[model samples]
Target: RTLPCSGRNLLPSTCGENRRRVVRALATREPNLRPGIPDLNVLRSGIAAVLSVALAWALRSDSLLWASPVSVVPQQWITEQRTISGVVVSVSDGDTFRLQNVGPFHPTQDRHHEQSFPVRLAGVDAPEISHFGNPAQPFSEEAKEWMKQELLGKSVAVHILGRDQYGRIVGSVRYTSGLFSHDLATELLRRGFATIYRGRGASYDGDLSNLEATEINAKAQGVGIWSLPDEELPAEYKRRTRARAF
Candidate 1:
């Protein structure tokens, strides 16, 4: 079952994990779903993913929103709802990935994707060139570049939330290339390129504030943007600029 994007507290009663995986799903994947109790694990994870992917196709009903260099695609669309798993074959930017399985589809019947997927980041907002200044902030480009470099052409485990407003897969970028990885929010903070977007008033996004504090500490240490006085504007002005755009 799917839950609201703003509901983090709901997960404690849903998934066995203490943290809210629901928020992770919605914020990252923006899936179409009504709140319900869900179990998180290998089998359940596959089912939820396929459910979301099928739902996304139904909502979109258009052309392919994404493609990848080496994607595992099905010759036919999902005719029935089922779970599937795969590695990310591509990353669109800071928050989106294209995934297709490697080796072989999960041996479990109805447990894997034979096609690639295009997914959206759920909760956090990274600086898009469109939202930046007229020419766009140089740092925004840097941030995107860094994100692409870091995750592009990597293998990732995706957890689905269903379709979003645009019908893209709503999932998180977990393990990549058989290694643990940081989500977009963490990378943004690590690079000193983003803020929590507190004004947008997202639920799990506040969790990003914890990362923001880490960014502050990194800045204090003169890292990334902090290394440059010109790019380092007062917090108040930074907020104003971001607000005006997004």
Candidate 2:
């Protein structure tokens, strides 16, 4: 019987295979062995290769570049079967907010950090940052800041709509009201903070939000967000997104 020469020929789990392959590859690359001078050229080339690999690993430890794509890492189950309730940790500006959801849900199954979900307001667009301070309007920053203040550190409820195109939970979010006076999005519109974002006809959600929008506008000529500069109109916001300007 012939002795195994490499890993391909070995049965399995041979610790010597790696060392054997490396030594064989080194020898194959330099067929002639100098008896006394130590084969400086081949030795130098081997050292250079080792140093290059070491350098790449060292750099990858600190930077994402040169790192292997983590495509093979198995994804864990995240969406579970319990309703979550918590104070909003932060509002990532209009349309998206984060919730803590302390007790009602436990992350015994999730592998992600910080149990926060991004929420999208179903029906509106408030003034964009670019809409501020021009002859067009004055409250763009104030609107954004107001949204932050209201949602952050306050109680809110989120209805999970599964995941969206941007990996956010496409859900309806409303502030916590002891009296259940209004949902968060409707109240935001009433206070002139957020505007309704109508969905495409095919995927339109319940008409409740649409009616809320009308009621909000009926009050005080669209007082808060309704009074934004016409340049920052809802239609323009849609175009800006479809056009991918921002």
Candidate 3:
């Protein structure tokens, strides 16, 4: 006769075989134990191990990392769709700005207990302004000054796309004043203050073709940076500078 264990019934034949195996294993481990009896300690340990494994399996997720805790910081802003709204407090360039009053929490570089962070425009690259004594690219100041006038102290909606290598939030910025609404990237491209970003992870909201058309029109009109005959792309300029440094 085979006894049921742990509220589960087993086939009589299989249960008898399993019992014999356990008895043999226990006897080998404890040489002085009675022939048909298992040590109470051994029985308790075996039950504990079985329960632990069952509990672990129950909590397992599809991810290989097991059951990971939910992050306080959101990890899937790009694919999962996340957005943050705040006022543009500062304009660094045609395609970069500082946003504040997001919340009581800031993801990076919290200053004086204020929720503020820098945001880089997705799907566009503006000319580099003079920094560290480097000469400014043509129309860099024009781009920056124009953005400051247009965006400084304005409330805007940011659609988060991803984070850049520099740890800046990369997103699409939408500005609304009265009844007029405009996207920062499209406006920059339209005025030739910036170019379509061809780098990796160049994400944007809305139709991509619209931005392309805007850039094409700017080029046809020979306006802003397009007026220069030998205008260098910001990405290309950065590469050249790095190569020269090396």
Candidate 4:
């Protein structure tokens, strides 16, 4: 007799015997099964794992560093410049600020819906503010105070560059009109509140010559942090402070 499904000849074979052999073969080849469907046990395990991840995601109160599947499509980074209009709500420091009521010039479905978020000034590095009992970097307070007086509650246009690792938008902030029409970062450099940040992996499409020139002028004028004979860069100051703590 020959089984119709498998087309295999079975001498003195019973239907029950043929069925048992077929089941055994399937079990043996389960790992290499076509269509990639796992056996019942493995399928159950996969389902459980998926359920666990979903539950964890749902229960998470804050940011989760979830591992996502590799995407086939290339991610579209913000290479092209974008302009947004918003009023400064808060100044975190000389080079970082918070904006409220932000709206993009060209609205799209993918545009951020949040009314406010942190903005880090591009092409500039400001002195670090005091925190956790660590001494503030030279001119840190002056930088923050200057920003507060000049930017807080003021409407401005943000020339979007890209986002930083801390999720803050990196951009060149400028007033829409008036005497203070130049980029905020350049102004900070001119006032010696910030230095031209040319650190590795820095990304800023805007011309940095103005920032460099302003910084040189500030240093020559002995203004702000430049007045200190041995002022340390903000990054160096942070490294030294952290080293001292431990």
- Top-scoring candidate (lDDT): 3
TM-score of 1: 0.44
lDDT of 4 at 71: 16
Put down candidate 3 lDDT per residue, 24-143, tens digits, no spaces: 676688357878999999899999999899758644422211121122224654455466666666778778887773432333343222345778999899999887666788889899
Better of 3 and 4 by TM-score: 3
Stretches off by above 4 angstroms in model 3 are: 1-73, 76-79, 103-114
How far is each candidate from the true structure, as Cα RMSD in Å? 25.9, 18.6, 16.2, 16.3
lDDT per residue for candidate 2 within 156-223, as digits (tens), equals: 55544446577665555656445664555565666666556655621224556564656456456757
lDDT (Cα atoms) of all candidates against the true structure: 0.52, 0.53, 0.74, 0.71
Residue 36 error, candidate 1, Å:
55
Which is better, 2 or 4, measured by TM-score?
A: 4
> Residue 128: error of model 1 in Å?
1.3
Judged by lDDT against the true structure, how good is candidate 4? Answer: 0.71
The TM-score between candidate 4 and the true structure equals 0.61
TM-scores, one per candidate: 0.44, 0.50, 0.64, 0.61
Model 3: lDDT of residue 81: 48
lDDT of 1 by residue, 98-140 (tens): 6564433333233234355576654444554533344454466
